[model samples]
Target: MSNDQPLKGQIIIFTGTPKSEDVFELVEQLGGTPISLPLIQVSEWIEPTDEQRLMTCPTYDWLIFTSQSAVESFGLKMKRFGVSPDAITSQIAAIGTRTAAALTKIGLTVQFIPTVFSADVFVQEFKPTENETRRLLFLRGSIAGVTIREELPFDVDEWTVYSTEKAVHNIESLKNLVQTEKSSTLLFASPSAVNVFSEEIAPFTGWDTYKIGAIGHVTEQALIEKGAHVDVIPSTYTLKDLVLELIK
Candidate 1:
């Protein structure tokens, strides 16, 4: 590795949504050529007539937020509904530490979070007691899976507060880059991103020289299911951690 630019001659493509400019900057600092090929984008989903009911009612025993996007969308909708964050007196559950932090910043106390940051682990460990009623409300993205719903043995109401759409981008530049570069690395952050890439982008050739990386188990599974070979996955499920692992 070159001391000044360990990744100086490398090329990397980021295919996830909600990308951070800082991650690209970091890649440049490490001497890698970073490509912005975001395969999916998220938008808040709003339904006025049905959402209006939330402003006047606090009927849920628990509120679940699985992603930071979910937290942001829920916050915006709550404001539009005239429902304050504090007005919902239900216990809060977050899927990951980042989700918990996002909720905490908005003055909502998080009551539960799994150690593994996966839906399977969360439901297995945080089930309601047999006598207790679990009238949980899940605010999530349209593409987010229903693993919690499938695994949880209780009543849970889910509402899609955001939609994940395929992001449109010109692949010509990426194709040119692939042809010229010796090899490249692609990073995936979620299953939805993997699906978008497989469905919309993978048909193109020239990816044989590209290495693939996923953030964690769920994303890795998507990669496998899509027949994409994963070359790396961080022990921890975080972008920062993934970067560090890649640099290693």
Candidate 2:
């Protein structure tokens, strides 16, 4: 019933970028060895001319960051532009807590955040006030399928801040892992991982014996659509809850 209880001798595989270091540390602290295997790689949008313009812009209305990757990508570019990050004086809005933390790490504070961190809610927060229709700059990803522009309450400037690329697993590496079968228990935290993992394990079948743990409803739906017979799903939407369910 408690996550603090020992969970040794049980192996689990983490599927996502290194953004989940906090959760991984918790797993290790709780006697579980966390294996890192990123299903998708978050890449920064590389554009010489476009980035130059974004960096040289004067103070804008709002600077919205949708993902942690966008924050990182924009931060790197800002550093290159000789801006101490303090130069960008737009009221920042982070879509989620993680992205908010990422912004803080680079000396930025989020002015607004919603209860639901979806793109729909994110767009709705961009309505122009009575003062003036402030210009908005949205930092997103290259393959960002989720768009906040369509439902935007106010017309604002926007562009790709970073990009999401499906990571193609190394054949020999995957084969070796499958041959030894080290990752018997796979964890699907997001739907994006489910899509990428399906591709990762496509050529290496015989994974029906492995147990799958879906994190939330969205990931559960992705698992079901991918033909995975999910064996575990925690009621709460957190990694600690999922680890507790496994040990229980």
Candidate 3:
């Protein structure tokens, strides 16, 4: 290991979707052996009623996305329908820098992103004042909480474009990995990851012996609710911040 490889020889497991390979790469760059065990899976919504809603959607003052999944799902659907973002006159908003990046990657411009990385913070920053209701469209996952919808001043026209569920792995394989990589650092990016780990992975013997890291307040709450001790939690909610916390 080199002088800069502070995490040399560490085995860090990322518990998120397959799109989280970037986190794994960050771990590798820090000289850690990254392990992938996706704790969540995303699928297309069964009845795309939201697509229809968007198709005939009236002019809105703002369109907001809280997650990258929302951006990818909505952008793909727009492509399929031959719809152009230029057709919509509404301003776009995102909850975090990553979400904003996802929108920019697909040729959409973001007008707002909260400095803090949560829906509540986003609402606090942009919530309309009394008697200043704005027409808004929100693209989100089915499992998302209603904090954004409830906190905003106006009623948001929502489109559930995707659904998120816990990903399942072979029990025996996970058991073996737990046993073999007993010292590995486990990372959770969302409440769903913590829930899935509690349901599927924590049953294995000595599960609590592993080091654990969480990305944000919500994920840390889920970890605590599951009786898991989070050894590391970033002050900021981003995955890169979590990685830096782990290195510390």
Best by lDDT: 3
* Model 1 error, position 83 (Å): 2.7
Q: Encode model 2's per-residue lDDT on 14-47: one tens digit a residue.
A: 6766575777776677676777676778877788
Q: What are the models' TM-scores?
A: 0.87, 0.79, 0.91
Residue 32, candidate 2: C-alpha displacement in angstroms: 1.6
Please tell me which predicted candidate would have the highest TM-score against the true structure.
3
**Model 1, TM vs. native:** 0.87
Which residue pairs overlap in candidate 2's backbone? 140-161, 141-162, 142-162, 142-163
lDDT of each: 0.76, 0.70, 0.79
Error of 3 at 59 (Å): 1.5
Please give the range of 10 consecutive residues that has the lowest summed lDDT in model 2. 170-179
Order of candidate numbers by TM-score, starting with the best: 3, 1, 2
Model 3, position 22: C-alpha lDDT score:
80
How many clashing pairs in candidate 1? 1
Q: What does the lDDT read for residue 80 in candidate 1?
A: 74
Residue 124 of model 2 has an lDDT of 60
